[model samples]
Target: MDIRKATIHDIAEKLKITASTVSRALNDNPRISDATKKKVQKVAKQLNYQPNHIASALRSGKSRLIGVVVPTANRNFFSSVIRGIEEIANSLDYKVIISQSYDDYDKEVQTVEALLNARVDGIIASVGKTTENVDHFKKILRKGIPLVLFDRVTNELDVSQVVIDDYYGGFQATEHLINEGCRRIVHFSNSQNINIYKERKRGYEDALIKHGIPVDPNLIVFSKLQLEDGRESMQQILDSKIPFDAVFSSSDYSIMGAMQVLKEKGFKLPEDVKLVGFGDEPFTSFTEPTLTSVNQKSIPMGNFTAETFFEILNHKDQSNNIPRKTILKPELIIRDSSINKEKPKDQTNLEVIEK
Candidate 1:
């Protein structure tokens, strides 16, 4: 019963059966009766039988598997990002196991834990929208599993990260509104759990401060990052007599909702109310008035995240822990939404100095 010497032959001899029968039962072959399969598996496990996975994988030098985690696979931004990841992953002869966090902190922790149990060669992840903990990646780091983060990331973890210039993206978005004659610009802010949204909010606030425009405390509204939140918030904005002229939304989905309602309420885009959104999502441009938003090169971000993960996996012998990071700039894609006669480079740089 010693684990070291335990073998299929030993198992078969103990059960007075053929080695082929024992092997098939252990492998859970349908040809093996359920009772025999259960009995053989029990005895093998009881004897502490361990499959030679290392020997098998090392012989071929191929596990051919990777893991990718995102906040939500259904969201447009993440979907585009994953498509980019898959393109690289497939080219590198790797299969990716994908999971969604549903924006729940606890669920995200569990999903990562499960992926680790699967022993994926590498991991590429965008943290859940509400996840604040970095402890989940501790096991992966400790085990020397190659890890690369994209989009939402951990400031404390110090791992490889690929992200866009979120702060600057926000600044440009807000600045566009001001230039288009929006006197009262409203910002839809997100929580600090994710650095992307938090940085964006900072940029939005900075634009107001630089413009010498007194920051209206009520103008910044914190909402869940969703289309419904955008619609509800916009409805509230319409309900109020705040005399708002434009909106700078953190997400394209929310921007879409706000625009839809504004149009319904007899508001004119650009002429009366200018709108600009972030992420430059596909749907943004397809709307009646193409959305003016920041393009983060989502396709490249995904491919880069996967490529970085593989690099870490292959270069494991070179470094125990690699502090790899990639930063991508966001470009302001001006469309019909915000109508400005002349657009200057760094147009938002010089905010009107307050008296």
Candidate 2:
């Protein structure tokens, strides 16, 4: 077996052509005839010649690669967003490298460093839950790399960001529960430092105030918004002896956890306690009583994120002038969990409320 790696020179030698001609033909340069280009490509494949993209990037100062960092790829929402990002990115001839931080600050920092070292042209990220200090992200802007953030974001960094109207989503969720004859609603949220959750909590509060319902401190539960966290929050609420008529969670996972606890405690959904969740996860519809949720428009979110990234990339010189902020509208999906009245099977309760 040949231990040495094949190069353009090897392909040229085998095809009896100049190395320059081989390179031009491999790159599909118009100066090279089609027949020659095809012949060169065939020989290059036969020789297993791999182009050195790193070397090419070093010379041209462009890797033609984009990096995306998400908290986790396990959720359907994140995966859908990734798909949307890829749809636009692949069409534009740029390859995307996805990195998961698992919502860990240290891991997010390391991933950003690794992407920078790889010489990616740009980076798109959703800030992790534990990322209090954004110096690591600041380093990217200092190095003149275009960074775009989506979903989970921070106002501390002046960069382009794409997010759904979280405040509206929260308000809608709470207002829907209110309309369902729920006065005492439990709001499950996460860190207030994160803009999305903060805005959501604000919306929740505002909706209560708008409806003449006193905002109860005990009704608002802040947690990591995981399934277990939801369980703990619900148990705490139950133990506190607060008579809540509805529950609105910022995450579907947490809401699902609350549902399980409610079932265990012999509380009927909608009849006893209405429920609404954010991020219309696929499993929401498959539950015993389908869950009502806010659709964050994952597909459109991804498309806008990629578009913003490219916009920054195109205007790299002016990227620092004024940061771009794109906010998309969210949809509320109504289902059995929040509806007290009997809904028809074929009825689609998708509401796109304008804010």
**Which predicted model would earn the best TM-score?**
2
Worst 10 residues of 2 by lDDT: 346-355
Q: Name the weakest run of 10 consecutive residues (lDDT summed) in model 1.
A: 346-355
| Clash pairs detected, candidate 1 | none
lDDT of each: 0.80, 0.89
Predicted structure 2: lDDT: 0.89
**Per-model TM against the reference:** 0.78, 0.93
Question: Which TM-score value belongs to model 2?
Answer: 0.93
Q: Which segments of model 1 are wrong by more than 4 Å?
A: 1-62, 318-320, 340-355
What is the per-residue lDDT of model 1 for residues 1-355, given as tens digits with 9 covering 90 to 100? Answer: 5778688888888889998898778667889899999889888877777655444356555557687888788777788889999999898777788998888889888988888776677778888777766788877787777778898888878788898878888888887777666769988878877789889988888888788877886777788847888898898887777888888989888888889888898988867888888888888869978888887778878887887777777774835656767877777888888875355424222221111
Give lDDT tens digits, candidate 2, residues 1-355: 2415788878888889898998889778999999999998887777777788777788779888999999999899999999999999999999999999999999999999999999899899999999999999999999988889999999899888888889989998999888778999999999998999999999999999999999999999999999999999999999999999999999999999999999999998879999999999999999979999999999888998898788878874754557878888788888899987665423334443322
Q: Per-prediction count of colliding residue pairs?
A: 0, 0
